[model samples]
Target chain A: MGTIGDLGEFALIATLTRRLPQGPAVLLGPGDDAAVIGAPDGRVVATTDVLVEGRHFRRDWSGPYDIGRKAAAQNLADVVAMGARPTALLVGFAAPPATDVEWAERLYDGLAHECRAAGASVAGGDVVAAPEVTLAVTALGDLGGAPPLTRAGARPGDAVAVRGRLGFAAAGLALLAAGRDGPAELTEAHRRPRPPYAAGAEARAAGATALLDVSDGLVQDLGHIAAASGVRVDVESAAVPVPAVLGPDGLRHALTGGEDHAFAGTFPAGAVLPPSWTRIGTVTEGTGVRVDGREPPPGAWDHFPT
Target chain B: MGTIGDLGEFALIATLTRRLPQGPAVLLGPGDDAAVIGAPDGRVVATTDVLVEGRHFRRDWSGPYDIGRKAAAQNLADVVAMGARPTALLVGFAAPPATDVEWAERLYDGLAHECRAAGASVAGGDVVAAPEVTLAVTALGDLGGAPPLTRAGARPGDAVAVRGRLGFAAAGLALLAAGRDGPAELTEAHRRPRPPYAAGAEARAAGATALLDVSDGLVQDLGHIAAASGVRVDVESAAVPVPAVLGPDGLRHALTGGEDHAFAGTFPAGAVLPPSWTRIGTVTEGTGVRVDGREPPPGAWDHFPT
Candidate 1:
């Protein structure tokens, strides 16, 4: 197996980007100074996220492809949360000089596949040598002339709703941590988050006030909307969809588990939600997030401890 | 004065983004799921560059602010090389958990200031924990309805021209290596590159066929245009400007030094070049780069050695 050092920078880049099909919006693709992507709406939604080795994923637990997919999913979810259709993704990758070229190419494959799922493409990126593997993915989207659905737009009387998986990724993490990897689906969820990308526009069209991707657990992520909008969020435990596989502690995972990439939003109190949206709680005239009229579990995905 | 661990992620983020001014093209800024930037030309030019801590710069040599500025200059130069006007910048910063919060903020300050120099702004980004400090900067630009000026547009018999300093950064590296850092301008050039951002649109308007930023030396970078255009570039040493401060090895430094962020382009045989552009070479029907009819001295700044 050829290491990155053996292939050199340019050849490895060429190999990694070989036959990378450009998406419809990509006016120009890789191997250029910069990529030109069409933004027909006259506006582009941009978001960036960094995934580091060990802190974000374990190499033994997740394949490079899975890591790449997770990296793409997180940023795409952010763009979608802004009520935009993803256009292209720019990646900045860093790894040790000894990294295997095949591993890096597999990671690029994962990034490209995830972009395809979002109707986007891996437009362009930069690769450099560092101490550990790190992927910094920047996602760009077109807003389709719709005003962005920001977290600050949630009103006190809004009804909180969610679409897509909530606690599956966290459950998967639990299994992986305990060295029990039987549930393929659960473990897969941890490896690759499937964000409800389409639900963003649907919720926005349905007059959703505020929208966000549930990355750091449902309740913890909801706290962002609460803090940004100066409103209180009360997530009822019974209303949260905790799958049977999670057992008795499923509620805790659903409430505080992260990396699900589910779509969470607040609609008008009496508004009918789009398909697959489960009503979870209500926005009220207060501050902070609560579960069953009490404080939520203290778990959070902080980059650093307080 | 606190470490990142002491402040936590959210608080540090709030502090970093607080009061950050939005650029003219920003429809939505930081503190949201994604920043909405105006792509008035119906297209956005995007590029990403990663700067690793030890590989790109040593903390003892360059301050955090200088590192930030260097990162911004590199990506912005990429966008400009596409013949686009820079619009916005997104940064993905990864630092150790024990990193000083003040240092991180200063680095951000440097990023914001450099963006301002290019008439752009830091719209949004993400900060995460890592084993080392790394900055992943993504720059976006507007084409103003003009067709992109790619490297492949250069034809045989085109005139090769350059604008901005050629060997100052490399000279600075020499000074730093020899422990003589008195030449403030040269050393500063290495710490923070000042690319001729306006030269991009200027060259396009002047009917330049091909263009690129001299990130990896004049001969090396022009080799990109030569390879892409399937032509040979013969640089005239007499016409090339090598400043005296570069000393006896100025010509070699100008020819092979990297990271000057100078602008290089090819124009029609008799095209009137823009102001400040120095005619340095000619394109011919051949392969590879040459200096006065001889093969140029071989040197390169490769990320990974072959």
Candidate 2:
């Protein structure tokens, strides 16, 4: 296929939108100036995230497909963290005119695939020319009439739990930085996160009090919940799962590395959790995050680390 | 006075979001992973647009405030074109780390101001680092139980009407290009378009058959309605208003220049129109648009013009 410049904006949009499989939530899909989505519960949970070329993702390391999948996964995970079911996404893509049309198509395919996995659809999007590849995705979700599980809902006696592997993406990042080849799975995890999307709703159904997606490190992200709820959270490092691929520093990665996209929440003490969720710690009357007993090192990922 | 790099991401976010004025439509505002907006009508109209530095707006030409106002206005107009009341906006902004924090703050203030003008709120947003300043705004609106006024609704003999200025922004652009300083009003109009947001709902109330925001040139954009509705639209060139600053090229700009954000629609012949709407054209049994008696040149704005 020729470059996007040769195809022009309208033709490229036509080719990209032609076969997008929209779900029931999209009342009107991509052709119009705006999309109409059925928000059956009278409320829509919306969130947006932007990924820039060099800052968020390196094209040299991740393919267009991988980048797209990662972008969708991150935003979908955010909606899920609000205890909502993702219904649709609006993508704003900006790239140089000379960029390959095939690359753009593959990127969109990855977005469609990931949205399908979440039972959502690519409802609409805008495309524009920029100096670098950039993706700004806005995700919308329905609450299904359930009250959102906010970070402030964590109670002092709540049990902290988590779903999905921790630190696999971070380990993968470490491997990439060191120029070392990982066992294929760890490297793949780094490129595209497989967030347990269903776990958020499941946790809500099981009476989880507070929830958040673990985009930052586990302890670091849980700190947000602790601060919001005005309660203490203690993570039992031994209980935090470490994938074998992370090797000797697996525990460290599990504690402080980011981009795992895991689901973390708190539930009433002794509340039954679905098999996927494992109790990792407890909420108490305090002010911040602690590992077993003491405050953990502030090694979590900071976008603009001081 | 420091750069964004000095403030860091979280600190900057804290300063930016600490006092955002949120309207009642926002059920839950920022600080969470996602924002929840009340969609009382059981559905929502959603649209997104991305503006890149140098591509969409030049920093030297438009202030940060003007760019932000323009960005919010364009997206809000898209939602209005769907015959909905704008409720909230999600902004995803990416800028270089060296960018002045004050500029970012002013841009957000402009966004907040325009959203307030539409009776909407800044629900949530994301911030990231990119090589250039980029903004992706997603607007969400409620339809208030009204069916959307799509492009495919005009019928033969319907009278086409327009609300708001024609080619005003374009005239301003021309003046800016020529370096001939005109009225401050024209220069401001180029920097920030005052889209007739309320006119959309009024047109719907007036039984408009089709509606669209006049972003692209009048003929090019109206041609969309003609193609979708499979009808011919004939504009009375004499009836189209021209701002005096445009001089002789006023007619050309009225037909071919873009970025006006005017509301244009078609109503049944002889139907009573809202006071602000003016009959400018008539729909007939052919396809495409005509100015007076001939097809106008298709010299509309294209992001990647061939």
Candidate 1's C-alpha runs over 4 A off are none
> Per-candidate DockQ versus the true complex?
0.82, 0.76
Candidate 1: tens digits of C-alpha lDDT, residues A1-306: 779978888988899898367889999998889999999999899999999999899999999999999999999999999999999999998988789988998899999999999999999998888888999999999988888999998998899999999788989899999999848878899999999788987898789999999887888789999999999999888999988987667888888888989989999988988768999999999999989999986887776553
B67-158: candidate 1 lDDT, tens digit per residue: 98899998999889999989999988888889998899889888988898998999999888887898999999999999999999999889
Give Cα distance to truth, residue A68, candidate 1, Å: 1.2
Reference-based lDDT, each prediction? 0.90, 0.90
Indicate the worst ten consecutive residues by lDDT in candidate 1 chain A: A297-306
TM-score of each: 0.98, 0.98
Which is the leading candidate under DockQ? 1
Least lDDT summed over 10 consecutive residues: which range in candidate 1 chain B? B297-306
Interface RMSD of candidate 2, in Å, is 1.3
Here the TM-score of candidate 2's chain B is 0.97
